[model samples]
Target: MLRLHRLFAVFLLLAAALAAPAHAGKPYQYYAVGDPTDVVLPQPKKTSLVLMGGGPDVDAAFAWLIQKGGGGNFVVIRSRGTDAYNPYIYAMGGARSVETLVIPSREAANDPFVIERIRNAEELFIAGGDQSDYINFWQGTPVQAAIQELAGRRIPIGGTSAGLALMGRFGFAALNGSITSEAALADPFDKRMTLERGFLLLPELGSVITDAHFDTRDRLGRLVAFIARIVNDGWAGMARGIGVDVETALLVEDGKGTRVGAGSVTFLQSVGLPQVCQPKQPLTYLNLQGQRMSGGGSFDLRNWAGYGGATLPFTVSAEAGVLLTR
Candidate 1:
């Protein structure tokens, strides 16, 4: 009886191990190009790229992108899991014109037609929602691969709020609650958090991550937390934290550079800092990398190293307003 019990336990352990790989970090293969900093523009035969803001104006952004195409066909995907309120359809003008592919659940993110649409899309847009839903549902699935393929083809991929969060090479999963100014100032490190790796297909934007509703939401503390995580993990020696204000968008052109729109984009760079972190303390012993030019200031992705001298010490309440306004 004892031997039989032990055998059962061993079998259970093996079964558990086998189950783990299904959810493990399976490697994603991508097409390679020379120069990590180089941005690849989509061929003219491909699709046009347009990343829009998530707000009352989201539809306007979409319409603008579609009109910009001069009658080219396009497809839009709504990643928001709930059908309660669809900005793409009702709020946005997408109600009658474009067919909105609504993935109301995480499981729907794997639909073959959805993935195929993304792969062949002239324009792909991720609608706003809780970004954590995106990380949990789409990360490492065929949907993610299709987005990567569209990006590689240089097609415009855009999102708002949660959707906007997915724009960066490294996107905050937002598994933790929304990082508000109060929470961020109180504690940079929040619980229920995990980072999504390799969601965006651009290498130039690697080591540079983004957050939305920056100043309005007081996301400085959260952005600081994100930077600290990157440094602590040694994933990249230096990283830039880009906080985009609500109603604002940053159009990244083939990774060659970024164009600011609507609100403003804040770039936070962390200079020299010890890799070690004490438990429960705002990441200390670090230098602030300094802010990027407010608005209309552009930097070559290849020459990002030139902006390294501007690190600032991480602060919970640093006041840097939007540099550009529409």
Candidate 2:
């Protein structure tokens, strides 16, 4: 009888995945692992965010999230993907159950039940997919409101890749697809460089934009170009760009950011306007303060400099759409 029940459950899961529509559509998808009932564990909470680069899951970082999450209901939310994370995160223990919410459209983002599922989360992880779906579907909707409330409650929240992209207060929306470092340096206003503000609106990440697959994708030049746009657009007097390498994660809390997993986390800051940044032309940005930290290093988010990382101040310039480095 137990074997029959297990087989039936697997059948149902396969059926659901098969039944789900492709892309944006009415109704949302949900999958769960472990205990069937939602458990709201009562415990003191403190907010922490994990900025994960696109790659293999960071075990230590997720463990930290589960720890900070109060060992309660862990929820994974994504615009696409399957229940893969559910079992993956659940196997890590500490959480009562792991659930995945597949919210695919603006209409589904407004669904009361969907919003409620999000509201009940103790720890929320935004899985990798297209950031545009999150922006177009959830931004300014009740879904956003629900997430804001969860953050207000000081729950552990995280994201990776497209998930990590929108974690910043200001970020590249990727609405027009991804812009390369070379293309961005050539023309900061390239159509592919579609940047936007006020997605997560994490005050802790004030005047900041984040990029993923940093080293793997060679995104530094583009991130610098992004800084130029943010400063030029009057978003803030000073702008910060955080680029996390593949398999790396930044565990942030209490005004401090610590590196975990593989590779290094890059921190770049721009305080002055670009000497030459305009549409249809190359870029000229100078003296950007940068720092690179490997595993176990910590950064002082408040002071913009901290122990355990290498300081790397650099400059970038372009001649007729040709990027030149110093």
TM-score leader:
2
lDDT (0 to 1) per candidate: 0.55, 0.83
lDDT of 1 by residue, 130-213 (tens): 877777777778877787886676555667777777776677886866655444433445563466666775545667777877
Q: For candidate 2, what is the total of clashing residue pairs? A: 0
On the 0 to 100 scale, the lDDT of residue 42 in model 2 is: 66
Residue 98 shift from truth in candidate 2, angstroms: 0.5
Model 1: lDDT equals 0.55
Candidate 2 colliding pairs: none
Tell me the deviation in Å of residue 160 in model 1: 1.4
Q: Residues 199-280, candidate 2, lDDT per residue (tens digit)?
A: 8766478778999999989988899899999998888889998999999899988768888888888888895898888998
Query: Which 10 consecutive residues of model 2 have the lowest summed lDDT?
Result: 309-318
